[model samples]
Target: MNGERTIYSILHILNGKKSSQTIQDIHIFQLTSLYQSFPMLSREQLEEVIQTLYKEKWLVQSLDNHYFINDTRKGELENLLKDNPLPNYLNGWKFHAITEPFWQRLSLFIQVASHLSGNSIRYIPVQRNPVTQLWLKETLHSIAIDRSNINKYLYKDLVKCLEEIEINPAILINRLTGLKKIGLTSDQAALEMKMDPSLYQLSFLAILHFMIERILSNKEDYSLLCYMIEDNKKNYTLTASTAKTYDLIQKGHNIEEIVHLRNLKQSTIEDHIIEVLLNVPAFPVHSLVSEEKMTRIKDSIEQSSSKSLKVIKQQLPDVSYFEIRVVMARYGDS
Candidate 1:
């Protein structure tokens, strides 16, 4: 229904005619006129399309002022022919028939089509038309950079693009806003626009560029930014390390006294003395200092560390060497 399709259909009907296909032979004037009867193109517009085809080398003009298909140009057009998605009547021109300028025109067509259809334009495949593909890719890359909350990696990628292009921040911001106007997140917009994600991975590199630029702009601000980045990294690492130290404390280490005696933070000495009490159990002071005579003898050197205890009168009960050791550990620390 568009002019491009109209031109293709007219050419198809006139194919293989040795003699020039005049307005009379093919009745093109009547065809254009009849089509124009119902809001068809004006006379001037119809002539302009014919002239454009000639300029593209599609139409050859004979000395007699009659027009025919140029064989070479026809070959180019034939290469672009594809099976129609719809009926032949509705089928139109092949997208690749036109030059890059034409592809640019088609992008505009897509924009208008989307507006008229009242739907957001999501994806536009330009694989077959490399020119349009490149344009769409650039458009997508530009869109993903407006918000700070946009994926961190994606933001970095876009910055890399700006760096490669040598675009100023002000210009970059404007391009980002252009993407926002079309309802796209920077990352989504770039993908939808068919830009290579990896190509933008230079975002990290762009950050370095920004730092360098800032340094040149004003040294003090650059220093502060560097310090802030470092401080945040250190703070996060320290917080995680502190959490691990608390886990050691809860596992029953006498870490506090050890750290205090060494004039260090408890965290710094946890790994060194973790096994200090591995084979020992805690004992109360009262158990070793009992006033009973049997208990007193247990604490004496003759009874202490003795492998076997003497069995005397029934009143002087024997105590195990293990008990003496425990008493010594708990209360005999002289």
Candidate 2:
């Protein structure tokens, strides 16, 4: 039932196009973009869902290599979903998923709980699917056996927060570990609780957020947690233009090729490359800059009072802005 509802949500987004819109056929790329926003399904899973929908006559393919919602079923699904609206957190989750700091903090929370529980568990970064299960298991286990000050505080604080929010603390425990003491999927838990899956997801997120806030507030006392959650020493992010350019580059496009394909100026493409180089640590800096040129740029910046690009550009007048940008990208603060 949850899978069917997920499919309906996808259809709802697809069918949201204006009636007079010419882009009737939803392309695979468009669906992939939509998945980034919702992220409830992977591309492979989405393809499988699409196939199932096609079999059920809920979706149809066009000659243009695109898909569309079946007109007859569209209205009925839309009305049903309207009564049980999609969670407001659907889009917000996308940002949290992409933000490295958020996951780092969550991973620390799990690791701390595991250690305090005497589980000797190694911490791996939390992924979207199993976060709730991991949180509930480790937290409960810590509370049960460990009488450490931190564990006791965490247990008490979480209980107080849940109670204040008017959510049954036991429901989380029961939902995650059903009658057999095995975990249930979010969908199965939703069914057991007689709540909409979307609502359950939102509720879970709220609880998670409250716990996170409580932990973060006492970060000084929870120094290990704070250290673990800190962003990589050099925090950086790609701008929108750079992100597009980086995607093209990943697809094996050269600067000229990217400029041609994107219909952007060569200089603009170069600027985007610089942005990518500056922001992405694993980017092959050596590929773009020679050791000699990098040294020269670094030396020039160190000598200059101002770290401005224009200042550096004046020092290396013969160099193009693109080359100077590469130098700045390597040496400058993000």
Among all candidates shown, the one with the greatest lDDT? 2
Backbone steric clashes in candidate 1, count = 3
Model 2 reaches what TM-score against the true structure? 0.40
Candidate 2 Cα misplacement greater than 4 A, ranges: 1-42, 98-147, 159-334
State TM-scores per candidate.
0.18, 0.40
lDDT of the candidates, in the order given:
0.35, 0.53
Error of 1 at 53 (Å): 46
Distance from true position, residue 85, model 1, in Å? 40
* Model 2 lDDT tens row, 117-212: 564454442344465445545545654344344545544544554555555444455433211244456688788888877567655554444444
Instruction: Show model 1 residue runs off by greater than 4 Å.
Output: 1-184, 189-194, 201-236, 239-334
